[model samples]
Target: MSPEPQATLELQRTLVLVLDLCGTFAFAVSGATAAVRRHLDIFGVLVVSFAASTFGGISRDVLIGATPPAAIEDWRYLAVAIAAGVVTFFWSPLVERLRNPVRLLDAVGLAFFAVAGTEKALAFGLSPLMAALMGMLTGIGGGMARDVLLADVPVVLRADLYAVAALVGAGIVVGGHLLGLPVVATAVAGGLACFALRLLALRRGWRLPVAGGAPPPDGDA
Candidate 1:
């Protein structure tokens, strides 16, 4: 590869790694918060954190035939999740003080994971459409697992535009990649797309219309 292209590739790799770790941390926080709300013990909190942060990546890797899963192969991923859980555990009161902390953190994680997943799928030679779906799965899988563990309905199933935001973010990355945009540029664009849409939905109560003749339940209900 030419020097410019090589540099871009390196930049993309670095950005993906950074964003992946950040997403892990964000998801860990979300999980830990949920555990705390449920009055789970510290161990349970950490377990939830690890599951929420890594299971999504694990699911993506497994589906793509990446054996052993990066979450289990790489020690850093576990460490990040544990660290996030420990921090959140000790600072539960502070975190609870924040307005809608779990949702906000989950939104950040969702955006980053969507970009990371799409990039990884593309790297694994998947077509753009499949890669986008992988991205959406990576964005929501962990939260689904966390909710299941807690015996609560998954947020992705009920939240306004949750999966839609993930899909849009992945689409942006795929579209940008096809247009020959740098990986870092595409990731930034995609992450911003997901993040902005999530925050906007939260702020303005934006939601997809539900099944006909049945009034949609309130999100906060």
Candidate 2:
């Protein structure tokens, strides 16, 4: 690759690490909160928390060519998640009672990871559609894994904006790239799009249109 392209790739990798750490921590907190709510044992909580936060990123990386993934590389990603889990284990009561904080932090993780994943895919010269899909995976994969662990329906399958927000964020990044926008600017715009969409979904209960033209539940059919 050209030097410019190489530099951009490096920058993308660095940003992925930074954002991954934040996302990992946030995911861990979410899992820990769940475990605490269920009154799980300490060992189970730690394992679930660590796995919930990192498995998605690991899965994304492995699919896109990063074998073993950064989550398993350098140790910091897992460390942060594990630490957060351990901390939350001791602070179970506080984390469990505060639903807003869990949602807020999970949103934070989703926004950053979506942008980071999309940017990384673009950096690797992937197609826009694939890039967006990867971004959504990065944002929601962990939570899906988390839900599966807890034996609940995946959040992405629910009537919520989680996956939609990730897709919008990634779409912005892909569009900006197609227009030759700078990487950082594209990432910022994409991340903001995800954040805004998530917050809006939370505030207004936005959901993806249903299949088969399901009639509105408000008697508007």
Which candidate gets the maximum lDDT versus the true structure? 1
lDDT of 2: 0.83
Model 1 lDDT, full chain set: 0.89
Instruction: Compute the lDDT of residue 164 as modeled in candidate 2.
Output: 87
Q: Give the range of the ten consecutive residues with the poorest summed lDDT in model 1.
A: 212-221
Once superposed on the true structure, which residue ranges of model 2 sit more than 4 Å away at CA? 1-6, 211-221
Write candidate 2's Cα lDDT for 1-221 as tens digits. Answer: 22447777778778877988888899899988887777789988888788788877777788889776778876898789889999899987787777787888888899888988887777667898998999888888888888888888776886688988999998998888788777778888888889888988998978778777765765234
Q: What residue pairs are clashing in model 2?
A: none
lDDT (Cα, 0-100) at 131 in candidate 2: 87
Total clashing pairs in model 2: 0
Once fitted onto the true fold, the runs of candidate 1 whose alpha carbons sit more than 4 angstroms away are 1-7, 100-102, 214-221
